[model samples]
Target: MSTTGFDYTITRTLDAPADRVWAAWTVADEYAVWASAEEVVLDVRPGGAWSSVMVIPGGARVPLTGGYVEVVENKRLVMGMNVPGRDEPVLMTLDLTADGERTQISLSQTFDTAEDRDQAEQGSNFLLDSLTTHLAAA
Candidate 1:
C-alpha cells in the first residue's frame, strides 16, 4: 500500500453548541485558549490576518500566522496557515455542523508536498484535540 498525495481531516464532537464552537475559531480570546494554546490575535473576517504563539509541551513557543480566506457565519471557514520555515502556506477549511446537543467540527488541511501534508496532519490534529479539551473545559 502506497500513501501518495496529502489530504487529512480531523472531526471532533464538541460539548459546546455550534455557536460556541464557532466562537472558538472566530474570536480572539477563545481561539487563544485552544488552537494556539497561548496568546493569539485573530482577525476572522474574510481577507483578515491572524497570528499566534503557542507554548508547546516542553515550553517552547511556536509562532503561527495565517489569513482568513472565507468565513461563512457560524457554518464554515477557510484559511491559509503558514509554518515559519515553509514557503507555501497550507490550505485549510473547517466545517461546523450542529448535532443535537453537540457540534461536529471538521478540520481539513491540504499541503503542497506529501511530507508536508503528512507532517501537518500529525501535528495539527494534536492541536484539534487540544481544542476539544479546551472547549469541553469551558
Candidate 2:
C-alpha cells in the first residue's frame, strides 16, 4: 500500500447518501451543527478558513483552524491545518463514495512523526464519531 511519513487513514460508512454527506461538509451552518461537539465554524469553499474550539474534560479547550486547499464536489476534499511552529502545515484529505444506501468516507493524513500521526488519528476518530452522531439526527 502507499504510505506517507506516518500514514493515518480512517474509513466509515454513513447511513446517508454521498450527496447528503457532502452537503454537511460543504454547508457552514450544517457542518457546525453535526461535525463538532463544541464551538465550530467552516468557511465551506476552496481557500476559505475554518476554526473549531473543542472543549476537553476539566474545561480545557483547544482551538484549530485552517484553509481549504481543494474541494471536489461529492468526491474529494483537501485542507491545510495550522499546527504549532511546524516547517509545514498539516494536510487532511477526504475521499468519499456513495453506495446505494450509504456513504463511505475515508480520511487520509500524513504526519511528520509517528506520535503526531497517532495523536491526529485519535482526534480524528473522535471527530468522526461526533460527525456520526450529527448525521444520526439528520
Candidate 3:
C-alpha cells in the first residue's frame, strides 16, 4: 500500500497472466466471480459504463456506477467511479505488467479527500484478496 497526495494505491503480484487479469476486470461474468459484488455490468471500452451491486455481508446491497475513462487492452484501465452519496467521482487506474507467468496489478484510486480514500482502502484490499482467491481456484 502507498499514498501520494489524495490517492491511495495498492499493488499485488498475482499468479495469473495479464490477459486473464484483464478479462476479470473487463468481462461482467468474470468480474462477478471475484468482484465482491452480486452482479457486474461492464461495457469495457473507453467511455463505456461500469456498474455493479455489491452484496456485502448480512445481505446489504450497495450499488456503484462508473465509466471507463481509458482502456488499453491487457495493460491498463482507468475508471471514473460514481460512488453513492458523493458529489464527485473518484478516478481509479489499474496498471498491469507481466512478470513471467504472473502479473503485477497496480491499482491507484484518487479521491478528493483523505477520508474518502481511507474509507475505500479496506474494501479495495478485500476485493483484491477475492481476486487472488478466484484466480487460485481457476
**Which predicted model would earn the best TM-score?**
3
lDDT of residue 78 for candidate 2: 93
Superposed Cα RMSD, model 1: 3.2
Pitting candidate 1 against candidate 3, the one with the higher TM-score is 3
Q: Which regions of candidate 3 deviate over 4 angstroms? A: 1-5, 85-87
Model 2, which residues run further than 4 Å from truth?
A: 1-4, 37-39
lDDT per residue as tens, model 2, 1-138: 236588878999988888888887777767766654356777768888888876665887788788899988899889888888976678899989989768999998988699988998998898788788878887
The list of candidate 1 runs beyond 4 A from truth reads 1-4, 84-87
User: Candidate 3 on 41-64: residue-level lDDT in tens?
Assistant: 898888899889988889889998
In terms of lDDT, the poorest run of 10 residues in model 3 is 1-10
- Count of backbone clashes, every candidate in sequence: 0, 0, 0
Using all chains and alpha carbons, the TM-scores for the candidates as numbered come to 0.85, 0.86, 0.91
Order of the predicted models by lDDT, top scorer first? 3, 2, 1
**Alpha-carbon RMSD of each model:** 3.2, 2.2, 2.4
